[model samples]
Target: MASFSGFIRKSPDARLAVFLNAKGVHAPDDFNWQSEGRGTKLVNDINGLIAELPEGTQDRVKAELDHLASLATPQTMTAAEQVCTAQRIDLEGLQGIQDVLLMLAIDHPKTLERVAAQASLMQRTGGKNWSAFQFEDDGEPWALGDDIARAGFVTDAIALLNLPEHRKREADWYTSIRVHPITGEETEVLQATIYVEARAESELTFGPSEGLERQVFQRVLEVGIACNAKERIVEICANGGKKIRDQYASSFAKHFAPQSAPPVEAPRRDVLLNALLSNPSFPTEPADGIAKVQVSSLEFYSVGGGFARFEHLGDDETIYQFLERQFGAQSPIHSTGWTITGATLRIMQTPEDGTGLSVSDDNQCRFLTISGDRFNAAQHGRCC
Candidate 1:
């Protein structure tokens, strides 16, 4: 196969990727169905693209492409691995049934076929802590979750980054690609993750600090940015960027980069409070681009007086709900990125009424730390 370059050339915003990727190729809305004998649009179009590609290049990509296509099959574990290697499995001590199946597949298709085939006749074992299969052959322990505490954390990490919106993996693999907008340079991006699993407050606690809950999710996302941000930061500093190298970096983000430690932000807080209260946008979500959407939770501590106030709006509720449905549950149904499920509510100190939820009325309460659930785990923890 010969190499050829392709370009999307149009989209600057990553949000417009789908349209950009599919642009320039005109297939009949039904053309792929007619041409490829496939009823699916995505399938037919992909096949059409490969068909048009130079021959050798298609062969090179054929295996990789085929593997990706199988994830949609929604196959079950037991049937896919014909050999009932073990009835009980420990995912913690062991990786997972899927991991074992992966190593077996290279040598044992019979094992794979049997396991993949028997999707319906399956049973589960183990407590909420773990599960075992009733289809025990040879009493093997090819199970998973013996290390739910650790594996679950890693699994959660993979879920947050490699997959978007929680999609299943393909053939024991998760695939993703990043493309440079200007150069059309398609490159593989390796995903990184920071761990977050449901743990007791003691286990979850890190740093002798505040906002233990939000830190859980923040670490997960920082891993994503660290993949690219670290070198970028170093590059800027090495370039003799005076503002970051000498000014903000020393006082701001660098101080709090570590989860186990944080510097006192009293000085920064004083400076920040002036700008934030004046603009009230420094602490805005996105904290950068885009207009504020909806304020779900707000907690404020007045420096002049010791007090705390809390207010919550449901995910879809607007700030003006005082005029309407004010009594409905105000907490968030789900968190934004960390995927920690919880009812998000704002904590604020405001003029108290007998009917509202209780919060400190003293103004001296001063902002201890602004916090909320990143993963919405609060609701789960509460119900549990």
Candidate 2:
């Protein structure tokens, strides 16, 4: 038997070879440490050996293995092999560590181990809040909403959105709300928006592209219903629901031209509005009209050295519509080929609102009063 002290006395490579040989995995005469597939083979054989050992001995062996793995250079060990050896996650009989690594685009063993530890903690504590890991069916990687949230994993919305395989099939901007099974509280699983040229064109014709908003609202309603919070839902419908729906409808109608626009697959549903009206406790007559304007402003810069600012006095106009109106055919900005290099919309609301709408730290909107050409097209052999 290879004693722990004896193993420690050997060089790193020799330690690994001796450990494997002692565990009955005899090395062949031509067994070169640099051979292809050797790293994976070593990991698998070590994992198998650990599985057969007693728990205490397994821990001791894993500690020694981790020490040996730490000495591995890039030429000697792959990242996955190092992670498997160092972490001993295989002892838990869990899979999909590789998938998690691939999804996050993580290449270093230390980062992999750190994230894996967070995921393990999340799985232990998050209870039903954890979403079904989408990578593998049986062993779910902790990558989605509740898992990431509970783990306190520092990641952006875009990274979370791209983790699932069905990303391309979904709309660019949307929200996902998850209701806690026990607490019945609603949590925004993700609120992500990727503004691309195609998405912008589609939103310009139709309203905001129908995505997960309604579905998420419906989910909240269902949870409220289950909790016997009918009155709360009614209040939500009257206040938040009606306001959002009416705003969306107003924006859509203001921008949509019936004569030229293509037909939409389906109109946006007044989920919140319907919920308010359908409630038995609701008033028979129409509720008071929602206030028209909340006072918002838009500031933009042209590709050339031009700056413009506009205030939206009416609630019906979309930001796209506001931009189009400001930069329409007769406007000086229309002739300048104004390409939007960046944009941010900051919505300020009172803390009492509990809406939790705030701008991301990285995407904070800044007003640049004085500007220059964003890019020099002539330098790239193009006309400005």
Candidate 3:
């Protein structure tokens, strides 16, 4: 009967081509109105279809088609909302809307244009914050207005929530996002959120929280106590510098405790600390620079696992004093200078091969310590 390509290009609804294709005139999925020169005869077919539209629908169809045509060339994107009023449609959200629409208009031009027009109308009347995609409708789109658009909203919502991604990271935390339809504002205005689930296949992670994640894992014991959370809380970073704490602090605190669990004296060696310090880098670095030690993201990925423990944090005065004094000018052959920072000590030490002395949780005894700039290990057979 009619060519599918011509039907899509000119008809307010591609029903003509759709009908023909459904009747085996053409493959239903093959029509792309975007391509040029489907056939000269298709124009006559499209004109006939337009006559069947409910009048002004053609204007919406024309505008959308023309806009789609312009995408063949570079188009300036002004990230704004067109807010004149009922007198004219607001173009404020055009960029974001156009991005999705352009993709949809490729093959499903008529359907997408109708949705775009409906969305435009919805945005115009819904509220100042309504979005093109999430239109507050008159319930018609739900009743044959646009099932495709309605379904997109559902899929779009799932993608926006990052549900699957969150499930993958094994998040110990979670926050929600509700997008304001018109203005496109995402809920959880807080810049970043760290979600840690105790037993999920995915995690909501970002990059900004790397440093914070490190801090969280390193002092998880203290945080667990402070926040009063019982679940296996983990830290995640979505991107560079997203404040995951403030975003989900109340929940995080609630996840731990409604009220902070009063500050407790940090134990001699917290469990996490004990485990991490056992690693080579922890007990031997400058305490000042220790806070900024760079660890691989790999370590962050493993998180709370034995292998990823970082040793480049915290201060232990006794340990510092011992290393400083014992080694003194007569420390290990490779003397590692350490700085004392409150409770955390940073030291530099050569990797030990279990030779001179063995230090463990039980035998962390106190003793007089020596201090000096350099040490000759061969002469003094004293323990370091």
Listed in order, each prediction's TM-score against the native is: 0.18, 0.18, 0.17
Please give, for residues 205-321, the per-residue lDDT of candidate 3 as tens digits: 444745423222211110110111121222222221223223322233232223343222211210122222222253335533322221111111111222211122223434334
The prediction achieving the highest lDDT against the true structure is 2
- Rank all candidate structures by their lDDT, best first, as comma-separated numbers: 2, 3, 1
RMSD in Å for all candidates: 24.6, 26.5, 24.9
Give one digit per residue, the lDDT tens place, for model 1 in 1-384.
211111111111221222213332234444323323323444545556666756666665454333322321333432332224331222233233434443334345444443432332222111121111111123322212233333443444344344454433221211123333223344432222232322223235445565453233322221111111211121011111233223322322222232222222111100122121111322444423322222343333332333333344343444435323543343222122111111222333322342332233222112223232112223111211
Show model 2 residue runs off by greater than 4 Å: 1-100, 103-107, 115-295, 299-309, 315-319, 328-384
* lDDT to native, each model: 0.29, 0.31, 0.29
> To one decimal, what is the Cα RMSD in angstroms of model 1 from the true structure?
24.6
Model 2 root mean square deviation, Cα atoms: 26.5
